[model samples]
Every structure is written in structure tokens, then in C-alpha cells.
Target: MCLLFRLYFLARRMHLSWVKSALVLWRNIMIKVGIAGITGYTGEELIRCLYQHPKVKISSLYARIEKPIHFSSIAPRFNKKIDLMCEPLNAEHMGDNCDIVFLALPHTVSMEFVPFLLKKGKRVIDLSADYRIPKDSYELWYKHEHTDSENLTQAVYGLPEINREKIKGAKLLSNPGCYPTSIILGLAPISKLISQCLIEPIIDSKSGTSGAGKKAEASFLFTEVDENLRCYKANEHQHIPEIEHFLSYEAGANIKVHFSPHLLPVRRGIMSTIYLNHESFSSIENIQKMYNDFYKNEPFVRVRPLGKFPEILDVAETNYCDIGIKFARGMLIIVSVIDNLLKGASGQAVQNMNIMCGFDEKEGLF
Candidate 1:
């Protein structure tokens, strides 16, 4: 009887141990994710970020192609790290597998797949200009027909610093443009100043070749980009309207941005020099204090000390934006830098996903 009772208690203990182990395994289960347009620079960067994410498992990667292709064959760096195959963008297949879908597709392409993915109940974060603005504005700027106007109202602009609360409840997230991300964050803290004192902001932005995407073009060739610096779309860059729209909204005034974009020789990162003509320049000390106090609680924005400014290397490869302020003569100059592929695109998209899914804001980002 003593041996029988001992054996019974031992069996119970073993059963309890197995139950505990199962519970732990269930708690650590990862959320499944799908990526559309997985062949672009932003998509590749998204894979890089999600590969290290503890809470995410990439279920499928989609391209608008015919057959399945190995992921490593396209981006060799992900060879041993991710063994998944890139497949065609079939809504049924993705819907059956993933709860979240990231659209890293081009402007018009993302809109086509977004409605179907959303109908499948997959949360979407679009890294395109498609849903970033209203239908009419999109039609005007992108010069394309707007087919997804109904869902446009549902997309929250995915600039976490400005739209954190809205992003938390968003079903669709419109990731901001690279130029707009650097431009908006550099100027948001001083929106009140912009409204009250500023006349116009002349933005001179420079970005590396990778911001143009992985598409083969003569302008993006090695010889063209290596030793040359030239400005294109001087005052009519597509991002002009986007930057102006958001800044006007933030400043609570009608503001127009005089934007000029230049291509740099490097691979990634954007440095924007915003020259603001205000009624009068604030004392350098006061301006610095305002910027410091504004971003004091923010996680990713770093305001440089007085007399020191931001450089491309300061924020390259990281999901951080660095801003430096300078007052020259009667103009306030703000310099901001960010890695175009990371903070400006994929990293910001991940940040929005975290907010929407109730994960840590910095999860998979650091």
C-alpha cells in the first residue's frame, strides 16, 4: 500500500510538470506574418527586422509573380537565416496562414491587394503612397486613379510619434514617406513656432540611391550615382504635397513646403536641411531647450547639443531620427537624419505593427 501511494503521487507530479511545460510553450507561441512585394528594398529590410523578432514568425512572402522562388536566391544575405520560399500573392493562401500582412509593394500595387487582404481579416501596414493621403489628394499627386477610397478613411498615418494612439486601434496603417518622415519629425516639435512665426520652410533633402527601390534604372546605375550630385523634381516632387499636408495639419495653419530632393552617392540614409524664415529667431538656448523638452520622453528622436548637428552616420542602420537645430542670421535651420530603409520605411512599419497588436513599442526594433 505504501509503494502504491508513492507511485501514484509520483505520477501526479509528472503530469503536473508536463502541463506546466505545455503552458509555457503556448505562451511563447509566435504571431504569424505575411509580406507582399517581398522583393523590394523595404521588404528585404522588413524581413531582416522580423527575422530577429521573438514574437513573430514569417508565414509567407509574396511577389506578384508566377512561381515559387527561394528567398535566398533573391537576397543572398538571408540564405541560412530564413529558409522560407517566396511565393505568388494569393489572398487565399496568405489569409489561411497569417494574421498580419505587410504591403511593401509599389504605390498602385498595394491598393489592389489591400482590400482583399483586409477582407480576409488580415491587419495591413502599407508602405506606399496609396493610402497615405485622401483619395482626391492621392489622385492629384500620384496621377493615378484611386480605387480604394473606402479603405482610405480607415488608414491611420503610421508616424508613431504623432499618431501613436490612433495607430493602436488602426486596422490599416499608411506608412509615411522617407522624406516626409525626416521632414515631419524635424519640424513637428516646433509646429507652434511654425504657425506663429514662420513664413516658409525651404527643405533641401538628400537621400541615397536605395530610396529609389531595387528596380533597375539608368539614373540609379553605379556611374550615374557614384560621383554625381544633382537635384531632380525641384519644386514638384511627389512628396511635396505629403510633407505640406502633414505639416499644415500639425501646425494648425496653411503651410507650403518648398522642397528639392537630391540623390547622394551612398546606399541609404536621408539628411534634410530645413531653412525656416521666421518672424524672428529665438535665442539659441531657448530653441535648444524647447526641442529637448519636446522630445525628452520620445524613444527614437535624438536632439543634438547646441553647436553640434546630426550627420547621416549618426542614424544609419538604426531606427532612430537625429535632429540638430541652428539659428543663422534670421533663419532657423534644422538638420535631421535617418536610415531611409530602417526608420523611414520598414522599422517604422514594424513600430506601427507593435502598436496595433499591443506589443512593446520597441519590440523587434532595438
Candidate 2:
């Protein structure tokens, strides 16, 4: 009958419209993110950056407390913008709610939660020394037993400039330390030259007190650090193995570096001066050109011109690493600078997340 035909047509049209609506809904699905150790400095920075991400929604935030407290209460600037509370550590709840998780916990603590998150099929970017190196090296350097050694090989070092392809497919990302980031970015491009030219390079780096963390410590007090600059962990810094491991891979040989880290009186930023000695002098022009070519297409690395040098102000508060190169008196000195909290930790973590999630690498960073 005519009535039956009309009903059939109406149903077909409705089905087609339903299909279209479903497609649109799928396309606009936002990625839900969770942050563990939400009270830490890196976690705060992650919250700040990810809040602006177009395709992201911060679904959960976990701190080390029992009762819930509004995140805005701790960080009052985000009062109106972010309305979530910092919940207690519950890996199962985070894994159920979030598509990806950023672990800003202390070194050994991250390894404990990572296995649970991964078992629940969640991606993780750990901003700790836990998974940066192999288990043996981690135990040797950090003096802690790695509970999840099986996940070590699965973790990709989350330096976007050097490991973009690997980071894209990674489930676990080990965010580099502030010192390692500044030191590695400065040395990675010329790793081959460093291997062939120098016996040992002396890396002198200075970082602001914020690198010490937000924890209340007498050593990091205003009075203690006000007008003082001293070197700690001169040759025994934990980041030594991380820097050397990556550099050795790039150089295709064993390489050693003498590293010294100093604490500056300021708030945030790292300036690393790498002293290189070559058997024969390579022209400053060629050296600068080599660096320029190496990082020309990279979005985050900025190489200065031949006679100019980089300062902390050049890359402070941004996800950028600025390098200044020079050759003088049988030595090649490279100055690299970055904001310790941004390029060194949280911003880089977001960069890795963007890559892993198939978003633009610079998303939410600007």
C-alpha cells in the first residue's frame, strides 16, 4: 500500500541521518587525560598546557592524599578554568577514565603505577628517572630496585627532536630530566664530532632552584639559595648515564662526558656550556653550518648564527632549545639553553603525548 512505502522511505532517511550523526560524533571524540602526582611542579605545568589543548579533556587528577581537594584551591589561578579536584592515587579508576596518563611521581614510585596502567591498556608518559635507562643502570644510579623492569624496553625516550618516529608508536614514554634535556640537545647533533674529536667534554650547566622541586627543603629555602651558586653531584649526577647512553647511540661508539651541575639563584631555566677540544680545528663557519643543517627542519630547536650565542632568555617559558656554537683556540664551546620546567619536563611530555595520540606535535605548547 502507499502508506507502507512512505513508512519505509521515512525509516531509510532516518537511518541515513543517524549514520551521519554517528560519524560526526566519532570524529569529534575528545581524548581524556589523567595526571598522577598532580601536586608536583611538572604536573601543574602539564595541567596548564593540556587545559588549552583543543582535543583534550583533563578527566582525572591524582595526588598523594586521602580526601579530595579542588585543584584550583592549590593553584588558585586556575580557579574558574579547571573545576576538578585532586583525587587520591587509584590506578584502576584512572585507567578506566583516561585514555592517556602522565606520571609525574618520584622515580621509584612511577614504576609501581605504570604496570597497572599498562595492564589496563592506557598510555603513560613518566616524568621521572624510573624508565629513562635500563634496569641495571637505574638501580646503579638511582639506588632503587625497578619493580617493572619488563617495561623498560617498551619505554621510548620522549625527546621529540630526536625520537619522533619512535615516540609516535610508544605506549610508555620516559620524559627526560631537566639537566639531561639541556645537555643532550646540545650534544646530540654533533655527537659524531664529539666522539671523533674529543677525549672527554666538560659539561658545565646551571639551573634555577625550581629544578629542585616544590617540596619544602631547607637547602632550597630563599635564604639558603638567595645569593649562592655551588656545584652539587659534580661528576655523579644521575642524568649522566641517560645523556651518555643516547649520545653513544648517536655517535655509534662509546663516549664519555664530564658533567657538573650548579644551582642558580633564579626561578627557572637551564644554561649548559659544553667545552669541546678537537685535535685539529674545524672552522667556525663549518661548525655552525653543520648545526644549522642538523636542526633546520626541527620545530623546537633554534640554532644561533656563527658569532652569536644563546641566553636563558632566548627559550625561557617555551618548549624551545636554543643552541649557540663557537670554535676558539682549539676548542668548540656549545651553549644550550631551555626552560627547565617546560622543555625539560612537562611541555616535552605534552609534546610526546601529541605525537603518540596523532595530534600535531606542537599542539597546546604555544
Candidate 3:
């Protein structure tokens, strides 16, 4: 009887230990994601966010151009924490390295590596202009011949609010531009965008110096932009068509916006003020209620109080887009702010990754 009882007790303890180990293994399997172009500011931010995510892990970091150097040599933030070599972007290694990949390189740059990733059967969230728009638009505006034109239509535009359902299942998603991300989120809650609507939206966006990239240029020099704001890519900016395309498609009508971009002196952030034409101003109470209803569950969007506008400082370090709406002379004026490097680029990509990988959308973003 002593031997029988001892054996039964030992078996029960072994079964419980096995169950615990199984749960731990399941949890880890949900986590390991990777990043491409990890040398860039946005890529580093993705790494930073994943480092904190309970359900995600940065198992790999890739950079084709920034290779043959230590991560810290390229970007000091990853100094010792990321003591890994920057490897080239390829599908051949991703299955061994990571399950999800974020391409934070330039538009044209991402196009070259995607076919390999697809062949490797890896999911992608591209933070580049290459896959953001339609193929013809990419060809016309970017002036680059697309190597993956056939796959362009299949790449889901990864704006969560408008295309949440599709994004949840997409194997490849193209994250929106910083300007378009801010502008669309600011305008969408209140936009009817009907063809007969006489509203002409003027999206005046000003971004910090970081939007230009890490490369040094005389134009982006401190002496040049210290206290000045210069508008570039005015009415004909590339983002204009993207904004119009999303707005029009969402509202089921053609829409045109006078998009104007400006460069600011700060290091990071975007402040976009949208001016709308409406015969009668929507009451502040109604506007707030509407926006609140629309984005109530969206963890990253904040609708500011009616009397107060959002400042860049409030959203500078977050993956949030702060939107404040005001009305005057029958026009709705909106101010939307975002940390261009975070919400505009990497955070959004991670959010899309969470969706694609069947993790909670806010797993790493919030």
C-alpha cells in the first residue's frame, strides 16, 4: 500500500509539471516576431516596443544596407541591449529567425526584398511608400519600376479603423504614410466626403526634422530651420493622392484635398491642422460624442476636450494620435498630432503585426 500511494502521488506531480511547461511553451510561441531595417529610427522603436510586449518578442533584426557593423555602431540606442549583427533582408533566413517581419526602409527599397519574403511564407508589414499606394500611382509618383507589381493589389492598406477586418487576415500589409496616417484619422470620424458636399479640406501638416531621415542635408541644418517653418510638397505632394484615395473610398465618393507639408525645427512629431467647409458647424458636443463613439475602443487614439487642442508634446513619445476638433464660421477645424516615428511608422506596423499574427491589436502598441 505504501509503494502504491507513493507512485500515484509522484505521477500526479509529474502531470502537473508537464501542464505548466506546455502553457509556457504556448505563450512563447505567440511571441517571437522580427524587424527589418532595424537600424532606422522607426525600426529601433519597434524593437523597443517589442521588448516590453508580453505577447511579442523581437527574435530577429535585419538591415541590408547597414550590415557588416554592430547595431550600436549604426544607432547608439541599441548599444549593448541589441548586441546582434545586422543581417541582410531575405526569406531564406526569416523562417529560422522570426515569424513576422517589419520593413521600415524607404518605399523603393522594400519592393526588392518582398518576393523573397513571400516565397519564404513570412508575413510582412511594410513601412515604405513602395507598397502603400496602387501600382500605377507608385510608378507615377515614385518614378521607380515595380518588381512586384502583381502583388501590389494583394497588399492590404493597413489602416485599422477603415480596414480592420481585412487587415486582420492579411499576410502582407502596407502601412500608411506619416502624413496620411495623421490626416485620415483626424478627418474620418466627422467626414461624410460626399460628392455633393462642397467642403474643400486644407490639410496643413508640419513635421519635425526627423521625418527627413538621419542623412545630413544643408537644407535640414539647424541654421536653416531653427525658428523657421518651410512648406514643401505643396498641393502636389505624394501623400495627397493616398489621402484622397482612402477618404474617397471610405465615404463612397471622390474627394480632393489641398495638402501642404511643412518642416519644423523639432526632432520628432507631426501637427496637422485640417480645415473643412461645411454650411453649418457641428456642435462641439455632437462632434465629441461622434468621435468618442467611433474611437471608443481604439486604445491609441485620443479625442481631446472641446476647448483644448492637442500639443505635440502630449503625443511625442506615444503610439497615439491625439485629435482635437473645433468649429468656426461653419467650418470644422481639426488638429491631429503624432510621434511620426512611432504611431506614423513602427507602432502602426506592430499593430498590423499583432492583427496578422492573431495577437491582441494592442499587444505591443499601447
Candidate 4:
């Protein structure tokens, strides 16, 4: 009886040791994520998406605050879901705590903190225009001097459909803008066709008021935007150069877009209607097939059926870019739609992080 009792206790101790080891392994596998600029729409969306991610633990939240405060206090929607604190923007503290840091800041502001975070060996995904184009283009269009030329040269453009392989190994990622996301994806598959036919694509993009960010501008006021449609930048928007740069890269020749952006009264999506001269192209059936073939392997891009076009409601509140094509009256019209806050900004950032970290591309998004 004494021998049997001692053996039972030994087996119980071994089982407890194995259980502890498994728990430690599970904790180690989770990615520790941090967010800077947690007050903006993109930042808030990031918190919402990352909180639902299975492999992520949001370790830190930073903003330009005087003292640390609960994130839920600022964004009440996350009250029960995310109980983290929004601390002041401390690069060192974020670097120490997080394996990856997302900068949802504006253009000039992201450059200030990126180099320091890189030096601390933390991967960065910037959802700003800072690192998207060359230094000269940025300076010319944005009217701001490019400060971090070294990192800018190395930052990979984070469009998973086009730059997936590069994104997998990128240490610094430049997330594409909302308008560019819809426009570029609409035209990427037909890049060679545009080059071969010498076609100059004309893009008319409409976006919701939220694309302007959380600001107190008179133009973006509720009274101004309610039931009103206005075209702000015509052909000379800052995003023009960015769109041209990537499309040019894909086409292997210089590609220029006659882009005009308008403000819609609604709150969250982007629809870019792209018109191309289809004089030298194939039939409508063949064009649709081509787009289908090109994006069949892409996870988030959904190519709609022939004679059907995508609407803003089709992709609202999701990390999806729905595209439809039509050949009519010697013009090939393509429509693309995406939720501005999701696929355009924060959701795309998380997708890039998944690729970089070797997690499933659709892990957090769905």
C-alpha cells in the first residue's frame, strides 16, 4: 500500500509539469503588437481588428497624451473588448514591449519615430504616405521635405496582391492609402494591356467623409458634407504620384492617371470608377476572364461576374476589394469598392503583419 501511494503522487507531479510547459509554449507563440496614434480612425480600427486576432496580443497603445488613460475611455466601442491603456508616445517603451509596431500617424509624423523603432529591432508597418514614393516625388507633391531617405528606400510597399513576396521579408512596410488601394487593385491586372495599347486610364474616385480623418475642418463639417457632393482635388492630388509610381512599376513603363477625387455624404467606403479605351483590347468575355484568372489566387480580392458591377455596400466593414468589369461603347469601365477603414487602412496593415510574421493571411481579417 505504501509503494502504490508514492507512485500515484509521482505521476501527478509529472502531469502538472507537462501542463505548465504547454502553457509557456502557447504564450511564446503569440505576437506582441503595439499601436501609435491611437486616437485617429485608422488607429481605432487597428485596435478593433487586432483585438480579434488569434495570434496577437496588443501589448501597447501610444498617443500624444499627457498621461496614460484607458483606451476605452476615448473609443467607447472598445470598452469591454479592449481594456488596454493609451500611453504617451514613448518609442523606447513601445520598442521594449512589442515585437511589431504599427504607426497610424500622418505623413511627416511617422518619419520621426520609425528610425528609432527600427534601431530597437522592432518591425514597423506605417499607414502613412511617408515611405510610399521616392523622396523627390514626396517632396514635390506633399510639400514636405523627406527626412528618412535611408529607410524610405528600404520600406516595402505593403500591397499583398502585388508585393506579397517582398512583404514577407520586409522590416519596414509602407501601407498604401485608401484611394490608391481601390484604384491600384482595379488597374493592376490590366497593366500590360494599358502599356501595350498606350491607354491613359482616367479614374473618378468617390470616398466617404471619414477619409479626411478626425479633424475640425470647416469643409468636413456635418453641415457642409450632409447631403452634399463636392470634388476637392482634380488631377493634382498628392495621391496622384503614388498611384502613378506603383502602376508605372507594374507596367514597366511610365503610367499617368487623370484622377479626380470627390467627397460623398456617407461615412466609410471608396468606389473608383476607372475608364480605359478598349479599342485595342479583346472582347468583354475575355477581359472578364483575364481579371478572374489574375485574382483567382488572391484571398481578399473578389472579382464580380460579367455584366455585374460591385457596389460600396458589397464590401463595407470588411477587408475585401470587390471589382467588376464591363466593356461598353468602346470603353472598358472597371469599378472597385473597399471599406476605407478596413482594407484601405488598418485591416491592410494587419494583413501585412500576418504575411511578414508567417501567420495565415486571413487569420485576423475574417
Error of 1 at 147 (Å): 0.1
* TM-score of every prediction relative to native: 0.90, 0.91, 0.87, 0.91
Residues 35-76, model 4: lDDT tens digits? 999999999899888999998989889998999999889998
Q: Tell me the alpha-carbon RMSD of every candidate.
A: 8.7, 7.9, 8.1, 8.6
Candidate 3 residues 247-360, lDDT tens each? 877777777789999999899999999987776455667877778888898878998888578999999878899999887777788899999988898888878777665467
Measured with C-alpha atoms, the lDDT of residue 270 in candidate 3 is 99
RMSD of 1: 8.7
Q: Quantify all predictions' global Cα lDDT against the true fold.
A: 0.85, 0.85, 0.78, 0.88
Q: What C-alpha lDDT, on a 0 to 100 scale, does residue 69 get in candidate 1?
A: 96
- What TM-score does model 4 achieve against the real structure? 0.91
- Residue 78 in candidate 3, Cα distance off native in Å: 2.8
